[model samples]
Target: MQPQLQQQQQQHVLLQQLQQQQHVLLQQLQQQQQQYVLLQQLQQQQQQHVLLQQLQQQQHVLLQQLQQQQHVLLQQLQQQQHVLLQQLQQQQHVLLQQLQQQQHVLLQQHV
Candidate 1:
């Protein structure tokens, strides 16, 4: 082969190798970027999950507090009802005694 032709062929082979290496490097860089995006998404999902759990816990606490308040209110209402019932019984007794005294007075006057 002529010396100049051999040198040109060698340069051409070097150029092809460089191009192939560049393509492989580009592929690797793209794969790394995709992996980074996936990692970010996973982190966001984990954060959301943690927030959800915290909210659920808070809800449970609020529910327990509401139930306790309801129980206390029920007890208070029962106590008030008992007091009213006692007042009604006393009023009935007083009315009955007055009727009996009036009847006695009428019987004496008739005799």
Candidate 2:
């Protein structure tokens, strides 16, 4: 009877040890899952950084193209204005000559 009682006590101690080991294993699994989640988030952030860099590069190229187009349009406008000014000056000279001729003819007839 005494030996049977000792055996039961030993079995109970063994069951408690097994339960403690299982608890430790569960805690370790939870920690590993958390680490995996953190690694995934880090990878996503890196991908976003790369995408942002590409967009900025494209924006810079577009800005340069716009400035070049503006420069060309401004040159064309200045050339057109210069041509119009020359034409206006020529027209003014022709009108002045016509007026002078008319005045001279009228004075001669009066005299």
Local distance difference test values of all predictions, in order:
0.98, 0.97
Candidate 1's displacement at residue 23, Å, is 1.3
Lowest summed lDDT over 10 consecutive residues: which window, candidate 2? Answer: 94-103
TM-score per prediction, in order, is 0.85, 0.80
Model 1 misplaced regions, further than 4 Å: 109-111
Residue lDDT tens for model 1, 1-111? 699999999999999999999999999999999999999999999999999999999999999999999999999999999999999999999999999999999999999
Query: Which lDDT value does model 2 have at 48?
Result: 99
lDDT of 2: 0.97
Report the lDDT tens digits of candidate 2 across residue range 1-111. 999999999999999999999999999999999999999999999999999999999999999999999999999999999999999999999999999998999999999
Tell me the lDDT of model 1 at 63: 100
lDDT of 1 at 6: 91
Global fold similarity of model 1 (TM-score): 0.85
